[model samples]
Target: MGSRRHTWVRRLGAAWLAAAAVVGTAASSAAASAPTPTKSTAGPTPAELKRVDAHAEKQRERLRLPGMALAVVKDDEVVHRRTWGKDGDGKPITRQTPFLVGSLSKPITSTAVMRLAEAGSLRLDAPVRRYLPWFRPSGPSADRITLRNLLNQTSGLSERDGIAHADRFDNAPGGVERTARGLAGARTGAPPGERHEYSNANYMLLGAVVEKVTGQPFGDYLRKSVLRPFGMDGTLVDERDAERRELAPGHRYFFGHPKRFDPPYDASGVPYGYVGADIDDLSRFAVAHLGHGDAAARAVVSPAGLRELHKGTVPAGTSHRYGLGWRDDSFEGERVVWHGGATPGYHGTVVLAPERGLAVVVQDNAYSPQRDELLNATALGAMRILLGGRPAAASTDPMLDAMLTTVTVTAAVLALALLWSLFRIFRPSRGRPRGRRRIVVGAAVSVTGLLVLAVTAVYVLPRQVTVDLSEILLFVPDTGWLLVAIGVLATALAVTRGGLAVRACLAAPPLARTDPDAVRDRRQEARAGV
Candidate 1:
């Protein structure tokens, strides 16, 4: 009986082991057949790119931008080129239309400098004074500044000294010297090489140095050395050349509508902010950034030099580093080097992700207070398209729409109040005839309003940008003119109200001034029918 039980146990054990083995095999096969996740390293799909178009269109509408042009380069080749607005004359903008690229000129200027260095004519670490003997930094202990300092914005120079933000040097050639001398008076903005304070004056000196050393007009040097070599024929370094090239007009907002301006005349800040190029020429510019230049591109600057141009030299912000002229950053785990530009009537941005083999350039023919973020918004959207991500949101605009709305509403209210003051001046008041106290209050308010506008225009704005009444009138017509008009109207109101208050005080009722007893006798006499 015991032997029979043992045999049964052995048979049961064998069955269980066979069943377990079968189940394990089935599980392994199921796992092998299940889907496995793989990382995506592909360019945008056709549908995805089409979606980017709609996305860009939406932004243009939401921002009320007049027009825009964009180009995308992938794998060192132009993959997409598009335009989405009309020129100031209502002509349709094409990829060939030129727009002023403001400070986007910096990187191109830096590229030229890098090439000069490779040619052994310039040194990145040399003192700026080594090239231009007239450049004298005021601080005795802070006399040291290099070409790298200027490119990285660590030159300890301020945008002030009445040069960078001022109207473009209306004069040329000869004027470049006079304007550069003015920079000699510039105070140190920071300890040299300590921190970054973006100053167009830094690049101004760079351009001057380039011209001095090259013995050529800075514009001519750029045209021959960089633009010509890269086959960017349509690009113009001089504003005087803009009209001959058939460039697009810059538009600024007036009463929330686009207003075109005549071309600007200044050239003092050209190296820092002004270069006119169409999307096609700009692509050639972008191609050079990828370090895959053809023989022609390589001839302008060696690939090694190009890489050096992008190598980070200092921290720009938390995640960004300022290279020679390019700004380095990591976006979504990928390296990106980019730059942005703003001018009176135009705004633009150019971005490059060398590791991903992509570049994007965007230009807009519109300017508004909110445009600083708007141009950035448009550029990042294009980057999203190239990187297989959806362009969903915009950059954080601190005060464009909000400040505009507030200013508009305040202007409307003030205008209406001024009209009411006019009515008060002519029409008599009821009851107590509004005491002198009311006029005093009105005058106080008018004076305060005028003072605020004046302080902001003269003291605050010039600190941020070199601006005068005339330029403000053209660039920010709606906001700037409203402040002026309101101030003038308020001044008039104050004078009128103050004069009325004094007259009212002098003309107080004579009867009320009489003695109380005399007033009682006159009332009694009237009741007696005298």
Candidate 2:
């Protein structure tokens, strides 16, 4: 009886083992057929996205921005997006509204160059002349400038020189080539790779090089290789593209208020600062950079190549390093990769926290030199909010307010002074001195001083500010026109004062002939009488 029980137990055990194997096989097959989950699938919760939206809105209101668009991405998914106010066209800003992204185009251009490099079509360390033989900037070391130098902005191009050539508003074809050729006369301030200096000219030349190598228009190449592949269909590469899409206008700060500014399209600037795109387009770009298994990004650039683009190659500042086109810096002790862009009427910022898998893009319709820091901070604040930190309260820029106030007060004073001078010129005062020699000397001195002041205002001041007069007018019409008004008023005042002096001298009665003989006779007659 015991032997029989043992046999039965063995048979049941074998059957049980077989059944277990069959069930495991079925389970494995089901698991293999199920869809794979992605990190983006578990992105930031809705509540978190709502917080980011609220913070962004608050910042827009606090900054008094006329229009703004913001997007937040977690991993490869856009978790939140919002738009406020109106665009340059007075239409409510939407996901499709395009803003001139300014220097943000640098990164996009850099990616294109990198793509070519990866394909072995170009070498980063090769001199620019290898592609464009006519390329020669005015510097002894110009021959040493390599494609990498331009990519990292260490080609020794000066910001002042860049400003000199920027914002030409040239809408004609071949504008990029013309501008690049124009750089032959430009002098570099330092040796190639010696230091990093941000210059739009660097990218403009790169655009030219791309055209030469690819035998295609820069815009066409960019569209085929970068924009289209990345699904940025709304991005406008040049003036024609912008017009075709009816690109919205941007705003500039005038007396601390945002005003619509319909800037002329600059086709030459497309490679560096003129590329336009809406928020949705930029969100895709941000996702690609995050590298969270984005198929489109992978197809455009290899993972290693993307990493190289973000690597800090040179020191940009004490706290910042510049990669190919991105700035690597720390924000509140966290690694942040970012770039800030500003044209005349728009300001935008893209901030990425790679370690945290977070990206934020903030764009404001209005831009001002004084408000640049504040505008950029909005993106940083959004990042902080996403990281579970309360955003810092928006702070008013007292300095900007003071500057606008000073500009207004100075303008009024200049007008008053000019009117008073004109009044004095037309209606001479009885108490005015009647000495012709003194009047002539004073007028000559006053005219010379006024001429010097006018020249300095027109020339020296723009250099000191590191922008041309036209840029000042484009970005800050009030200040730009004020500079012009100052020159005009100073000259007018000088001319009127000099004219008054000349007229006074000519109108003065000929000095009474103090005849020495007459004086002597009078003295002799007095002596005789005595």
Candidate 3:
């Protein structure tokens, strides 16, 4: 009997193993037979591309963005380029539309500096005092400050003096001089070239240095040497006096209103030279940089100079670094040189992966309010396409990821608890009597609370701000306080509503009764219901 049992057990084990192997083979076969998604040559697949398009549209809608244009370049060719959103009059934005590239102006400035350097008209190591004898930073350090130092943003100067947020451009007499002198007189935050500090003042001073060296305004010098040479005829230098008929007005989000800024002059009397022109010209500029200084019938800088611009100068924290006006980030073992542009109302990003020969340009009218995760992902996605690799779904958004995880966990817990509460509340009872009055009161209270929160948030709070799109763009400063006050009101509404629901439940009939006779009635109803 023992021998027979052992033989039977062996046979059963063999049969189980054979069955498991067969199941495994079948599963593997099914997986292999499953249709794998093919990468689209035109762009991302319909669903993926739709998500990106929809996301851009939503941002435009929420931020009241007037227009947005994007161009993706692969292997030095513009593979896919599209424009979405609208102009001031609701006209569709096109490839030729010009949006202020904002701080993107720095790289262009840097290019001009390179040309000057190559011509021996300026030296990177030479101090600014060589040209602008009147230009001075604090004392000894000012004399030591070099063109390279300014480009690298290690000039030991705050980018700007304490300019009030409401006061955008300096309106004082000789505002540019006063602003420059104020920055020059400001105390140093670190020893010269000790560490990297992004100072707009550095670039501003560099602009002045260009003017001083070239015997013309910075704008004229940039036009003659950079823009004119490259045939980037659409690029504008003096945006202060831009033709209103041809210009795309910049817009900002105020409460719920999308407010545009009036033209004819920027806050600085210097013609908004620090940030100018739109996306297409910017990409042309990037193409020149990524293509080693020659692209689109323009040779803005020499190949060697372009290399210098991309050469890492100092460690940008731990993972990346800065080079001239460019940034160096390691993406999937490939070196990516990129830059971002931002002003009060608009945000722009230019990403280039030279090794992979990919470039992406993004310009958004809305300030992300968080570190720009979407912009980074877009760039990374473009880079992955250049590498012929699929972009993994892992999120690089720090704040968004945290918020999403918190929301998901909170939602799960709430859902489980809600289901549990409903299950218990609706459970069949043996003989308890129904309480229609309690249910009616609960429903009415809940409805009333929701209506009140909605009314306060949508109608009352927004009314306080007076979201007039027309007047604010005329450079009116009073709108700032209105927006702030309204945001506070909105926050108050959210907090009040969140707490009101729980508070309303406090008036709900008690599950336990104080009177002993009530318990008997409850028991009778429970029995009957059961």
| Cand. 1 TM to true fold | 0.81
Residue 192 Cα positional deviation in candidate 1, in Å, after optimal superposition? 0.9
Local lDDT at 304 for model 3: 70
Q: Per-residue alpha-carbon lDDT of model 2 for 1-530, expressed as tens digits?
A: 00001121222224323432442243100111111113433456688778788877777876788899999888777778889999888899889888878888888899899999999999999999898888777786988899999989899987666666778888777888887887776788899999988788788889999998898888889989988777788898878788887877777777678888886888888788888889988887887777653466567877677777777778876677888888877655567778888788887888887766779988788877656667777888877767667665555455444544544554566578778878987787777446666677788877876666566556655655565567667765776676677678778877887788887887764444234676688789899995
Candidate 3, 371-408: lDDT as tens digits = 24443444455555454554435332343334223323
Which should have the higher TM-score, number 1 or number 3? 1
In model 2, the runs with Cα more than 4 Å from the true position are 1-48, 390-407, 464-466, 507-530
Q: What is the C-alpha RMSD of each candidate to the true structure, in Å?
A: 20.2, 21.0, 18.8
Best by TM-score: 2
Candidate 1 residue pairs in clash (backbone atoms < 3 Å): 102-273, 168-266
**TM-score for every candidate vs. truth?**
0.81, 0.85, 0.61
lDDT of 2: 0.74
- Tell me the tens digit of each residue's lDDT in model 1 across 329-399: 76655677788876677778888877676788888887654445555767777787667665646552334
lDDT of 1 at 343: 66
